[model samples]
Target chain A: MVTFALHGVGVSGGIAIGRAQLVSHATLEVAHYVVPASRVDHEIARLELAIDEVQKELTELHGTMTRSGDLPGEFGAFLDVHWMILNDPTLSEAPKRIITEQRCNAEWALTQQMNVLIDQFEQIEDSYLRERKADVVQVVERVLKRLMGKPGSLPTSVAEERTILVAHDLSPADVIQFKQHHFAAFLTDVGGVTSHTAIVARSLAVPAVVATHNARQMIHDGEMLIVDGTNHVVIVNPDRSVLSEYRLKQSELDLERQKLKRLRGKPAETIDGHRVELHANIELPGDLAQVLESGANGVGLFRSEFLFLNRAGLPTEDEQFEAYRAVAAGLAGKPVTIRTFDLGADKQKAELDGLARVAPNPALGLRAVRFCLAEPKLFLTQLRAILRASHYGKVRLLIPMLASVAEIDATLAMIDQAKESLRERGEPFDEGIEVGGMIEVPAAVLAIGGFLAKLDFLSIGTNDLIQYTLAVDRSDEAVSHLYDPLHPAIIKLIALAIAGANRAKVPIAVCGEMAGEMTLTRVLLGLGLRNFSMHPAQVPTVKQRVLTSDVSAIRPVVERMKRTDSPAKLAALLDKLNA
Target chain B: MQIREIRLRNAKGLHARVAARVVKVAGRFRSRVVITVGERRANARSIMAVLMLAAAMGATVRLETEGPDEQAAIEAMVAVLAAAGDRA
Candidate 1:
């Protein structure tokens, strides 16, 4: 076979060599033909039965998703849409009318009705609306597949085969279903980085190349293919040398991963004897497993917002208490710093009742501490839960987006109130629980002394600090490039915060995207940031960086870089330090 | 017939999720409901029809209902739309 390669967006990073398995788009070739009038009722009944089967399948898929502790809110909504479409009069009633009037088969009749809907969608001016045609197509195809006796499931006989799945397109639901079967990688002719398939692939740590445009057509079944997800390239029928090179590269990666695992129990101390405390920032209670596997020193930032997200209604105090207790107990006595529900901003989904009015710029609007303070009842419930959980383990409360002394005062007052309520109810809680403040806002960094005076410790949230200092919304595509974490002003602010924490004799930790980043770890260590919190997946690699970081030696270099105003010089300095 | 004019409220607009919400709310009442956007009208209860209406974020559309529960239907839809509009 001739050697060739195809390029596409490599969304998820990994490598896999497997036989190609084509997953055809649900598009069916419906034969248009007149049916005998006597068989029309049978045809309609067949269509109804098929629709019933599809609904049952979707409902079961939804049930499976919910039981798996996945985002039922998202998958359930999609399934509900498909179910509604299947039961729609236009699909069921109109198709039956077509079958009787046109004397057509159920498949042909359904196709006729689907075309009418697609035509209407095609006329819509909005591109997003135009995209709904695909959803309609998927639903119609599911019905057609059922009518044709093709179950919407992977062939179990092929489960043992190492194969790369090639599809015209895949919905998020399809991605989840495919995950059950062992596929070497995923290749789709249609999708982007934001597609559900791509997102799932990344989270699953599977190789994926999407938007190949013609992968399903060009790649034949059982053809040997190399899916290089890291480069977004797929080599078809590679030469022996090329295959050997890839084999060598794969082994190297495997060995490197093995070496990193060896660092799990090792302390994140430098060769020069600087002991850096490495911790994990957990978004959900489920993330505790990864934290413990990564052997992080403790849970530095337990984002308590998970209970409020991806679902409707506020969790009761008991629900919150149980979630907190699970995390605290799972940590097995490691210090877990739980940040209160930092609602608003990007977390608009967490606001119960959706009562928070739309803000032109939510990042600067009613968010974090402001939102919690405004919703004191909700705040108190969460506070009481955290306090109760503290009794199980070393739990601390950390307030996010603190800028003013008055906000700190208000939060402390509420904390006291929550404790009083718990005390009045005779609830057991750790009275000696330490409360920390997040120095994210530039103003908070400047006023660190005031915050440190009242709080037990401080965690510098560099994600927001960089954005606030640069006056750029890092998420905004247009101005995102301007968000410089290593800007002179940002470095100065961090140094100032560290200086303030030292003078106040308060422990300081850096917890944000910057904290986990290998490129910035040495610089952070040089700045006297002894405590670091990040995703558990990043722990081992960051620990590796920490082991090599000589704080005593790099401090002077970091000091000089802090004084430099030139962006070019700063970039050069960072390169040297990271090297 | 009871008719009311409302703007799309959901910041992400009348996407699949918002359209699904609209369909669910419209399905609650006994009224025969139709929503008109620009020159196109769609059955309020059909997910496909609602999605096809393509009202988009901040787009003003007319909601028409004619049945026993016309007022209740209109109130529910208008309330949902306004809530969706409130989402950032």
Candidate 2:
């Protein structure tokens, strides 16, 4: 057996040894023949019919996705992207040109058109576009399958056994279809780190190495392969010693995973008796199960945006009430910190329609509470729903993107209006719900004293705080490399926010991407952050770190880190502390 | 022809989603629109062509529109590119 290795950018971290499952339909075999002059119109019509079917299929799939319950906002966005690709004149009109001018069969003509489109995508300097070449290929393949009279069913899911999926590229739809099967790892010839497939792989906790260029061509079906996603290496047909070494590594990882799972029941406290609250940031009502399973103390950030997304028109108060009630009831009296409608910015604008403007930079535009405040009718509807549900369980109101005390005062005033209106209607609701604000903006972080005076609690939204402070958009690959969480400025900001909250005796929490990261848990704890709100899947791992860490040991180190001038030194200091 | 120069203020620059938005708005006008970033020129109404320009967050691109709705088209395209306070 020929043994070899391939290197790729590791998008997710883990080690897996699985049988390679080649999912190659890479180049569809299409016959090129001159269409009869009279039948040119007929061929064009045939292609149009196939396009209609594909669109119909996509519409149905989008419907299914809206109902899927576990997916993130990106899934819907990618679906829309694919829909746009299908409808683009490049796809529809260009192929017809080949069919009419060259008198070629629809299938061959479509392939030629797709090649031109791919070439255009390939020429785009943005690597994001280069990665999107897979998306173009996926769309073409779907159409080609239809033109060829073949059922375009995605390879029947990843098999039950530990299977390393070797594919030219797996679309988000294909990944969703393979939902039931267990995947040890995924290696694709095409896919960027930001692609939906890569995002799903990370969320699923499966090891994945993408943009490998030719993993599908080199790896044979049913062959034993070792995927080390952490190292960005895939071992094909490893000899006896190598295979055993990987087997040992895999078992160790399995044991570590089990150990983390066991930490679910343990309290998240540092070794020196500093107790910290660990909560989950939930995206949907369905996530409550995972939250409870992970033993999170409460729901820290219940992103209410999900109800507003993928639906036509605004969600009625009753619909919002029902969703909030389910989560409140699900938690069984555990405090649910509901952040009101952090919509806009990366959210689909289809539902918003004319209500929202197309934000050029949504990250800084009318989003979160700003959108809520501007659209008071919409804001009041959500506030009324949240207030209505507060009576059922322990519900805390959290406002996102609070930059000034004036905004807070206005929000509080609105809350009073909602309550008075509720009182007049004789609606039963909780009158003393705890109010909080997300310190996402750098202004908010610095103005924590103002918030602490008016708010019951505070949560740092480091995701945006880092982005705004660093002037780096994490989603923008062009500047994504500069998006650093451990930068001295960020650490200093977090420390200052926490210190301010601590001095004022206001409870504080971190509910951002940084909270979910295991390595940063210790650093955050060191910075005097006593509460962490992250995804449920992250709770156990973070709790494990919390269990082992000594706050006193890290406090001094972090104090020095905050004073460190260089960004490199700041990172080194954090690494040293973690070590 | 009406020509207007604007900077990409969106954090992610004129990426796919931004380009899609640009194409959608540009397509609404009868005007033939062209966007020029640095040395590269792209058709404002075509998503692929607009994306090829690869305008980063701070890059300035000139929008040129020629038709009956030239003024309106340039204004709309500028609003999208300048994504001003209503960030992406």
Candidate 3:
């Protein structure tokens, strides 16, 4: 028997050696034909029935995620889009017309319509939005078959044996389905470091490799393969010794994962009693499930842009409210700070479609608050929803990309208008909701007095602020190494923001990717930041770091960082403090 | 219409169980209800819709509803939100 290695996404953390079971994403289009004009109404009814059936299945599957809180809000939105896509005039009518015009079968007609929708989805600018093309294709392929009077089938099937699951990118639902079967690990050809697939894999403790451009092509149905997720590598056809070595490593990984699970729900305090805040950055409302599982203090950063990104048009206010309310309610009485839409120049979700705002350097261009002001109505819809959600619990409003007092004023004005709409419309609301701004831009740091004067709190968005300051995208391989938050200027900016907030007696927090890092926790704590928001996976380490630190002891490092001229020097000075 | 800023107090913020609770409370309002975190928005009445925001405990989000039963819907939804991790 010939064995081959298949490269796929490593969704879970650990590795395993098992037989391969390839479940190819299906091509469900039916080639059958025969349509008469008199039967168009019958065909339409059949099509609607098929769409409803798919929607029902989707709705039920959607419920599982909602219950798990895996990604309720945005996932719900995607379903809504599916509902919309299923209901699309072109998608529905094209098939009937083709049946009438070409006398083709429902399956054949639908296959053509699917192509049209795929073309539209592929044209979207946002990578996340573009990736949705596959979802549409899969759904259409399934729906078209049903219209053609074929037995219903899954878009993709799992192998019956313990196999390494492979795909371009699997959704959280896919991961759950995979769990029902025996899978050694997950391997996928698609997804970014921050994509949902990776996040789910990390939570599932599945070993996954993403961005494996040729995974589907490189791997066969059954193969001897090894997936090293941490290193982002996939090896095919290993010798017997290498396979045995990885098998042992896989067992070891399982033990480590068990250790991580044990840390769940435990307070992440160090030997010393210093406590730190551990928060997660959430994209969809469903991801809150993992947040709760991780026992984080609360959400540090709530990314709402995902709701609007993949859809065809702007979501209504009611749509916004439903998403916010579930999350606010989910957290019970804990504080949830929702950052307003932070879609930069690159993410165009229809309204901003084809509206290029390219600067000589997009990293330093008109984005965040600038984009919000340029689209006030869109901004107002989100603010109104958040304002309404504030009634449910302790909800804080956060604004991103505020470089000046002016942007803050403008954003606040929108909130006020939202509040007025509620008032004029006789709506009840919370008066105590706190308003905050992310201090990432140097301009915000320089104008701290102005920002803190009006804003209630500040969260240092070190990632973007540093990227903008250093003119480097951490994702850019060429300049990623230069994207250091430890740079003297970056550190100084953070320090200035923290010092200003502390002096003003206003609370300060950091919610960037850096805030979750162990190396940076001390530096931030030393800078007088008590509030933090990061990924759930990082909470323990950050908390451990915080506990080891005496809040009082951090001042010395802050002092040293200020004295250092270069980022390397600053990092060295701070490293000595941790030492 | 009813509007409010609510903090997630439950240590385990908005998982599936909480989404059910949210849907139950939000469904009482005849008004179209929407909740927002930052710029992201979703329908509060549906569990699948609500879980997408991925909001964690102690985070802040906004909830608002407009309909014939807006006030009652708001109060009930807020109450459910406040009671998320408390008991049921």
Candidate 4:
């Protein structure tokens, strides 16, 4: 077979060499056939048997998951929903009626009823509820597979040879089942970075390339495949020389991963005995397990906006409280810094009423603390919830995008009001919960003293800090190349914030992409940053960088780096600093 | 036969998981439970039908249950519908 390459988005990073195992897309390939009048009853029986098998399959999967108790609670809930959908009369009874009326095969009859149910789901006004159509489709697909006599489970791999799954798409249920099989990697014809397949792939620490267009059709079963997730490339039926090269690279990656795993139990201390705290930034409470597994000191940033997104109306105080409490209690007394919902500016505004005016420049528009300050009720509800959760464990409140002293005073006042209300209600909370502000705006960095005096701690959000300083929208592809983090002004601002916080004895951390970049680890340490927060997957690699560096030795080079204005010269100095 | 109106108290209203809970609870009883939202009626025991109702938070839905155990079924359905958060 001729060797070829397929390119797509690599949501998970790793390398894998395996044989292709194509997951059948039964929904797309269901065969429709007319049944004779005498065979109508037999067709209806076939549909019933298929539905029964799918129900049994779901039940078995649920039992295995409950016994293992390793999957998230949501997985069990997903299985439950699929089970209910399978048994719903629309799925179970309507299809039989369609088979009797249309005199069609079992698969075709089921697909016809599924389309009708999906059409009804499409009429749902709520976006979140409407997305349930995918569940309906997935459930029908399961029954279709059974009706076609194709078992849904993966074929056991040949001894010692890895198997990679290639499919048009994967439902969350399918991914959950794949977890038990330990597939080497996943290649989907369509999905984005936030797709269920991508999220599960990252958690599994496997190589996955999504949105491969027609990967399901192009690659044949049992074809020799090489998945380079970091580079977002998949090689099929590779030549001998190429196969050997990829095999060598794959082993190197494996060895590096093993080395990182060993560092999980080690402290993030520099060679000169200076200790650095490495924390993880999580978007949801479910990520706490990974944070602990990565050996992070605590959660540095919990973007609470996730609870407020993708739903109609704002999250109620009780709803928000449960989420915050889960993270706080899960940490077992470790610090969990929960940032209040930082909505607006790239976040959907449909949920928040009266904030729908499209700003000329959304980044500079009313967002973050400004948006919260504008809507005091929303802000206070979140504040009350966070305060209530503080009773569980070490919880800190971090305010985002504070550009003025007035915003700081106002936010502090709102928080005080929240506490007073809780006290009146006899609700217990940590009275001395540390409050912090994100130093993202250049103005905030310049006026760092006001923040240092008012807030209990400070965190440098380098992504926004660089964006505001350079006046570039990073998401705009045309001007994204101009967004540089290594600019002299950006470095000076970060250094200033760190120095100010250190002078006042206030805790400081960098919780942005800059903190996770292993190449810039020494640079940050030299600037007196003792705390780093990043994605859990990045902690070990950055900790490895921290383990080898001497902060005192890099200070002079860092000072020189601060003085350098030329980009090329700065790049050279960065190389030398790492060396 | 029993009919009563109950407002949805959950923040997410009748989303998938909540609908599943309703369906599971309704399936336990022999009553034919029908939930009506602004003239859109759905059998509470069918998740697909209940989800298509799309009753948001604070939406006042009419629950009608009729069978030998209609009284107990309506009470249970009311408890699930009036639940706050995901407690149901």
Candidate 5:
């Protein structure tokens, strides 16, 4: 066997050594066979039966999704659209007509009709709508699998936990079904970092390499596969020495993971007895279980935008309230700071008309607090819901992208109005809930005195802060290398915010990718950062870093790091601080 | 037969979910609903046909209905098309 490698985008970070379990692409394997005149009706009946079975299957899956509430709203809406397409005469009826006219097998007829619809979808100019072709393909594949007597499920004979799933592409529905199996890793031939497959893979905390281009076609079933997700490489049929080398690396990772688990129950305190608070940033209430298991002090940033994304309509206040209340109450009296819907700029929904226009520069355009102020009705609805949820547990409201004191005053006024409306309606809420501002914009950091005086707390969003400070779009690959978190200016801005908040005696935390990053953990602690919020899976590892550090000793090293403008000196200073 | 013209008022025009909603509304009446956008015509009860029309926001579409409930069908189809910001 030849040992080779495949490289792609690594959306999640980990290592997995398992046998490749190929996911059969039913759409590509369709066979065309002509039916006799006498059997045309039989072929049509077969297609109908398959459609019926698929409809039932979709209905049951939807019910299970609703009952468990494990998946997001977008997944449920996708299922509903699939169900509608399955029942539409355009899908269920067109293929039967083709079967009669062409005297072909059920699968062949369905494939022909699917091709016609995909051609029409290809002509669509709107990218978002054109992407609906994938949904149609997924729906048709389900029915085809039924007609072929294939159940469209993972092979149960294998030990699924030790299996690496290799597929050409995976729809959101397929990813949801695979989530229950707890596969070791996922490798697909096509998907970007923001693809549904990648998002699910990250949440699963598994090693996944997407856009492999040909991993599904080249690798045979039951082949030895080593998925190095951190390096975005997959090794197939590795030689003996290479296998042993990877085995050692794999065990080292496992042992380190086990060691981190032991730190979960221990306090995230430094060697000098300075206590640090570690919180988890969650997007959905379903993540509460993992948050608790990781022993996070509380929920740091509950992004309210997930409720609004990928749906046709905005979520009603009651729906928002239910989600917020679930997370707040689930924390068992621990604080959960829910950020207002940070929609717009790569997170825009189709329902908002004002955001429909293509902004020349979305990063600098109307977003976050600006959009909220522009559309006060929508903003107030979310505010009222968050307030209502605060009655259940410790809930705080955090506003995003506040660059001006006037915007802050406008947002505070809107919150007051929401409270007034709720009081008029005779609803109960927390009278003195904390309101915080996210210091992502450089202007906000420069005007730190206003924020420290007005807001109850503060959170430094290092991702946006770095992007704005460096004038780099992190998503744009061409200039992404310029987006440096270790830049001296970023350090100065963050240090200034921390110092201002500490001087004012206001609580502050870093709730961004920087918080979980182990390399920068000591740097932040040395700069007097006592609170950190990151992904739940990252809590244990960062906690491990916090336990071994001496904050008092690293402060001077970090101070020297803060003054150096040279990249080389800064890098060396960071090394010394960590050393 | 009754024909009425209305422009799509939703931000996304006739996207998949919106097209599906149109098909569902058209199915509720005993009328045959056919919508025409530019030169392309589609059976409103068929999701694929409705989607193939590719009607964008502000695109003028003509709705035709002929059956026992033609009047009700025209009214319902017009309402669905004219719905702004589609809070479905």
Candidate 6:
């Protein structure tokens, strides 16, 4: 068979070889629009019934998704949003008018109304508000088919063994159903670069290739293929040589990944016994599985914002406590630092009502402590959660975006309130939960003395510090050249944060993309920042870097960078340090 | 009910890296999807389809999908096509 190899976007990691079936995604087969113009009321009633059926499915899916003690606070919140949309008097009432006035099919009517809503969402300046359009559209798509009695036709139930299904995009519903069968791999055409589908695929370790153009049209049924998740390579039919070569490489990668697994329970130390803390930056408690797989010392940064962003509304104290408790319990004896939500103005996900605030630059806007101060109730619930979770494990509460002594005082005051309430309710907690602030803003770096004096510990968020100090958006291609973490200013500020924290006899660490980079690993080690939190994949490489260097030997270069002005000189210094 | 034939203009064709990129991008739409490259065609919605296309570094293929999202379907396909080529 003539084999074809394809290079596409790799959203998830893994490898799979399977036969091809150029099966496009199975879509709902639209039956002919049979509704008479005269029998609009009767047709409308039928549409309502169909919509009701989909609503029932949506609700049912929500209930089935929870672990006995573990509530899906985020997804449950999404369902709440869906529930509201389902019963929204305006949306419900408008469709009827469309049916009467347009005399159109209910599906068409619903789609049009959704378009108007999506348009209004798009008009809002906030990207998060606009992204909500996706959720709204998803709910409508579910309801429309039910209303028309042509509820979307799900894919022909197939035993997914050795079969890789490709699609443009998948709804949360399809993902749940697809997981039931043992799929060889998955591919999609459209998902936000860092979308939920990508998150799910990665979580499942599915060899997923996304963003393949016309994937639905390009694949036929039961054709042999290979999906290389490492480089996101996919091979359809392979000649003998390529096939044999890939089989070898696949085995090698498996063995290599397996070898890394053995590194678990081993200390991340240099050949000469220079121990370094290698903790993982876990966004969710579920991420603990991979963190342990990588043999992380602990979670250096638990992004608690996920609890807020993942859910639809504010999570209750009990709900937040349960989620945090799971993470804390999973860590067992290891330390897990929980960082509170750092809501900023630019992020539409905040959903703070009636604050017409647009900052000239969100990086410098009312974010983190500033935003938390603005919404005390939101901050208090999270504080209560972290404090409650502290009893379960070696948990420490870390706050982000701290700029002043006042922000620190105000934050602790709320914590005090939470403690008082818990005491009143007679709920026990770790009263001695160590509280700390992340040193990210330039102001925080300058005011480090006051923070270190009051705070229990510190973790430096290098991404923001670099962005704020150097003024660059690392993601924007236009200023990609400006995204230099090794800039003398950034290097100096980090050194200052580390030095200041150490002087106060407080432990400090760096947890950002910069800490994960191979080049900067040694520089940070010499700067007195011994703790590192990074992506799980980056842990091994960073550990490798740590093992190669003596921190004492690496200090001179860090010192040299502080005295330099030229980028060329800095590059030369880095090459020397790496050498 | 429609089919559009297009050439993969990017010099790299549908290489492994490009195919993964294409699959990642194509997964964003919601329509019945498929593609054909020569006598072999796979579900464009399947990683196997684009991988099967193996249209070399620069090749041509046809795309088809049927649904209310067909327009977005075509545009997103072409967008990934151009992006995959560029990335490749």
Docking class of 4: acceptable
Q: Which ten residues in a row have the lowest lDDT in candidate 6 chain A?
A: A23-32
Report the number of clashing residue pairs per model: 4, 6, 109, 0, 0, 88
lDDT by residue (tens digit), candidate 6, A1-579: 566666677876667776653323322433335367888897688667866776777777666765422324455545545555565544566777888887877766677777777676576443444456666676776676555443442434365666777666776565555544567787766654345556666656677877776665556567677887668777777777777887887788778777766666667786656788998887656677878778888899887666544432355677778888888889879899988876774434534423336778776777887877888777777787788888888899888888889889988898899889888878778988899999888999987889988999999998888888888887677997898887888888988888888788998888888878888898888787778998776687788778788877787877887778888898898898888
Which of the two candidates, 1 or 6, achieves a greater TM-score against the reference? 1
* Candidate 4 backbone collisions, by pair: none
Tens-digit lDDT string for candidate 4 (A304-367): 8766433444667887888789889999989999998777787544545334667788889988
User: By the TM-score metric, which is better: model 3 or model 4?
Assistant: 4
Q: Go through the candidates in order and give the C-alpha RMSD of each one to the true structure.
A: 7.0, 10.6, 12.0, 3.4, 3.3, 17.2
List of clashing residue pairs for candidate 5: none
TM-score of each: 0.71, 0.63, 0.70, 0.89, 0.89, 0.68
lDDT of 2 by residue, A1-579 (tens): 999999988887789898887775735667789989999999999999998888887787778777765554455656666777888788888989999999999989888888887787787665555656666778777888777776453544446457788888777667665554677888999876655457567656688899899987898888999989889999999999999998999999889878888787788888999999999997667677778988999999998876644333356678788889888988998999999988877654433634658768788888888888998988998899999999899999999999999999999999999999999999999889999999999998876778998999999999889989999988787999999888888988999999999998999999998999998888888889889999787888889899989988998888888888798887788788889
Of models 3 and 5, which has the larger TM-score? 5
Q: Residue by residue across A1-579, what tens digits does model 1's lDDT show?
A: 888888898987778887887765545566677888898889999999998988898888777776764332445667777778887888878999999899999889999899998998899876656866877888888888778777773434364346788888876557668656778888988887656667567555678999998888788878888999989999988888998888888878878879999999888898799898999987666566678888999999988766654333456678788778888988898999999988889854623554557788888999999999998877888999999999999999999999999999999999999999999999999999999999999999876768988999999999899988889997688999999888889888988898789777899999988899999988888878889998776788899998987888888889888789988888998988987
Q: Higher-DockQ candidate among 3 and 5?
A: 5
lDDT of 3 by residue, B1-88 (tens): 7798899765445644455567666766679989887677878864434555556556687989898998888888778878764531
Off by over 4 Å in 5: A120-131, A153-157, A347-354, B1-9, B13-15, B18-45, B49-88
On lDDT, who's better, 1 or 4? Answer: 4
What lDDT does model 2 reach?
Answer: 0.82
Candidate 2: which stretches are off by over 4 Å?
A1-13, A20-159, A166-176, A186-203, A208-248, A304-324, A343-352, A355-363, A388-392, A416-429, A475-481, A562-576, B1-88
The sequence of per-residue lDDT tens digits that candidate 5 reaches over residues B9-52 is 76667876678778889999999999999999999988777877
A218-281 per-residue lDDT for model 5 (tens digits): 9999999999989999999999999999999999999998888888889899999999999999
Top candidate when judged by DockQ against the true structure: 4
**Deviation (Å) of A80 in candidate 3:** 7.7
Error of 4 at B12 (Å): 6.5
Sorting all predicted structures by lDDT, with the top scorer first, yields 5, 4, 1, 2, 6, 3
